[model samples]
Structure formats: C-alpha cells, structure tokens
Target: MPNKHPYTTLISAANLLPNAQLENWVIIDCRHDLSAPEAGRAAYDAGHIPGARFAHLDHDLSGTKQAAAGGFKGRHPLPEQDALIATLRHLGINDDTQVVAYDAHGGMYAARLWWLLRSIGHASIAVLDGGLAAWEALGQTLSTEAPTSAEGNICAKPTLVASVDADDVLKNLTNPQRTLVDARAPDRFRGENETIDPVGGHIPGAKNRFFKDNLQADGRFKPGHQLHEEFSNIISASQTAVMQCGSGVTACHNLLALEIAGLHGAALYPGSWSEWCADAGRPVATGA
Candidate 1:
C-alpha cells in the first residue's frame, strides 16, 4: 500500500513563503520546453524559486526508450522504480516532506511530477498554484544559488494508481461505463495540425478536453466549484475516466484538475497516443 499524507492539491506562493525555509519541505522547479529540451535547466540556472531543485521531464522523470523492436513504450515511459526512488531521495523528499512543484506552462509539466508522487503513494505533494508566474507576481525572490540539503531516506511504495494499459483502453472502447478524455489541443485531437506523432487523430471514442480548459486566462487553475461544474458534464463523480495526451505528460494536468474539482478516480493512460499509435492494428478516429 502507498503511504498517505495530508496535503492539499494546490498551494499558493503566499502560503508557501513561510514554509520555504523548513528543512522537511521541498520545492521542485519543473519548468521545461518540450521542443528545446535543455531550456528548462537553463531557465532554472538563470533564476528559480528560492530553495528549488530542478526536475527534467525526460532525464529525471522518464525511463529509457528502446524503440528498436517496433515495441516502443511511448516517448516518456515511467522511470524504473528504483531509479525514481533514487531521484526522489536526491531531491530531499522523505515521507513527511511537503513537495511543491511549479512550471511556466501552467501546471502541465509540474503536474506530471505531482501525479508520479501520488502514484508512488506519497500524497504529501502539491503543485504550486498558478505556478512560477504566480510566485513572480507576488514579488517572491528567485534564487540563483542552488540550495543543498542532505539526501533523504524516502522509499518508494508503488501502487497501481488507477492507470490503464493500451490493451485495457482497447477493451474499454465498448464499455459505456468508462470515458476516455484526451488532453491534447483541439487541432491535435482532431488530427488537423499534428506534428509530433507520426499518426494523427485520437482513439475511436475519445473526447477532447484540451487541459488548458481547466485554467483561467492567467494560467492558474480555476476555482474548485467552477472546475467541478465544468467537469461534471463530461464525467460524473462515480464514472471511470481515463486521461491521456501526446506522450503521457500533459494528461496529468487533467488529473490534477479533476482532483481539484473533487472528481476523483480518473486513471492515466501512460502509453497514451504515442504507444497506442505505435501498433498499426489499433483503430484511430479523426475529425469533429
């Protein structure tokens, strides 16, 4: 069983200011540019929240990709369990540590880290509400000085956190009780302007939510009640919802939004479109 922690889903920069100096708290800068790849570290080096550590999506979070045998495991496969345990401990996260992750692109990348922690059964994590922009807006200081702390003794207690594999997704297509929500943009979901994946279009019966819908104009998440209202129409509190995106990254934003909305039990399809499309026999759907 995964360990449980009493942590809120979102934490404001203002609320985090006082706790920033605590020894048991960890702030991770999850900023990343999917295109540039190295841009996240460069930006972190320039300036990041005080006492924040950098987490690279591809290097720190994902596992190695062996796309040799035509059985590639998607672009960003989950990191090996032991490797993830080492990375978390290196980041100074222990059982009681309060983790706050932030990113420039809304909470897209940061939510991935948040989801990973929760999947490991460590719920003492939250996404910095409104992200780094929210912190900057409050005039919080950014530190070029890398904060160092002794390595932590946190251990991984992995749990199967409501995720479905490609085969399960295929089986769910005919199951009316389940709903597949794609977090990609409308264009990408419709297979109109796809440039990343070799094949375009979404799963046969998937609906597009475009993760950004959960955010306001300022890039912060919408209020809880508002979020609940927006999602209630698509997924009920009791329904089983599966989230997915180009390569299992942005889909986490949807999962975060669902949690914020108090609509729980949504699972992640980590293999997502990247792995689903890898098999030529899988069905694809396009257009409005």
Candidate 2:
C-alpha cells in the first residue's frame, strides 16, 4: 500500500534504482552527524548515489539561531520560507519532480526533507527506505561525479501539513483532544540523557516513541499494517497527535512513519524539546 504512488511517503531502494538516471528525478543525500557538522558533505564528496546532491542539516535544512534570543527557536530552526524556497529552486526541483532523500543513519534526516516538501505543498517527495546503507547493500554503484542541473522554477505554495508552536503545546496539555508524541530515545525522554540540550525531560504530556522503533532490524520502516497497529496502540485513531524530537530533526522520522502507517493528520512540533526547554516556566516531565 505504501508503494501505491510514485510520490508516496516511502520508496524502496530497488524501486529507486531504475528511475535514478531520469532527468525529472532529483536524489538528495541528507547524511549528517549533529556532533560533526562537516561529516555529511565529506561523505557525499567521497561517494554518493549517482546524480545525488548533498543537503547539509545545518547549512541547507536549518535557519539561523539568534544568540540574543538565547536560542529560543532551538538549535536547528526551520529556515525562513523564502530562503528554503530559493535552496529548492537552486537544487533544480520543480513541481513535478520526483525527489528521493536518503541518509546513512536510517531515514532520520531524509524524512525532514520529505516533510518539508510536503509542508510546502510539494507532494512529489519520498524518503529512501533504509537510506544509504540499503543502496550499498543491494550491490548498487556509487558515483563521485556530480551533475550540474539547470535552475528550476519551483515555487512554494500554501503549506499543507500542520505545525504546532509552544503555546499550542501548552494548551494541548489540558485539551484532551490532542496527544504529544516524542521521537527522542527513552533515556532522553526520562531526563537521564542530557547530551544535546542543557535541560533534560520532555513536554509534560508527551509519550516516547524513540524514532528508531519505526524501523525494523534492518533500518527500513516497518510494514504499513504493523506501523498502523503500533501507533494505534499509543495514540487513538480519533485523537490528533503532534510529533517532536530533541531539536525537531528526528521528529520527522516519526511523522514519516505515521504516514507510512496510514495514520495521517499528525502535526509537527518544530521547536520540540530544545525550544520547549528554553523557557524555564514551561512544564517538563521526567521518567517514563
């Protein structure tokens, strides 16, 4: 069911191989380590999928943080809409283009691109299931040769996906209609892991989904039926859910997984834990 559309939320490496050489298709390599900012571009330079362009998490995907605001928007905020549209146009993506994004660390980073495109009303995007590892595991070849694409005339339309701000989250805490789903790991959700953000713990009412649970042992997303069953157990089919992570990156992974599970209408909390923790007055929850 997930593969029913060419522009579905998830696509397999095998399905991507044949059309990879096509002109209208754009493949992006979204590999990055939060600790080592330059590593993703370095890895892309070493070798990448043929014709794939590199999109760094910090440079291309995120916006600037104001020190004056004390990082109120979080470490990796969403790029300004105009700037992001320019970047996409520079990448030679059009309204009809088929975009495939991938990363070595599962679909964590790639899902962000998928969600961003979808949010901006561009529906022709998919995360490379299993990511870079899957491409290599299938005995496919990699290329260091980069292709130059003509500038595309893509424009950002109205946003289709829903997003929640800090205020909305605070209100949801008391509103029985919404559920907050945290994509961070169990330890981080419990205030035990404090590596990324200075403050630990999660939004008071959020439940931990760990992002990785969306994948199988091989790192590919679980089958749609299984995904639907898993998410349904945590969040009711009737309740609206908001997805979030440490700094809003991995939250997209859970969002993508939810779409694959056929559970649509879940919104993104882009500020996430980083933004939530920035203000001391906001409530925080510790332990499972």
- In Å, residue 48's CA in model 2 sits off its true spot by 0.4
Residue lDDT tens for model 1, 1-288 = 122544558998888888887777899999999889999999999999999999999999888766445567799988877889899999998977888999999899999999898888788789988899899999877889988888988877756257888889988877665788999999999999888899999999888899999999998899989989988887765248899999999999999998888888899999899989988999999996
| TM-score of every prediction relative to native | 0.94, 0.95
State in Å the error of residue 242, model 1: 0.3
| Cα shift from native, residue 99, model 2 (Å) | 0.3
Tell me how many residue pairs clash in candidate 1: 0
The TM-score of predicted model 1 comes to 0.94
RMSD of each: 2.4, 2.6
- Which runs of model 1 end up more than 4 angstroms from their true locations? 1-6, 67-70, 158-160, 237-239
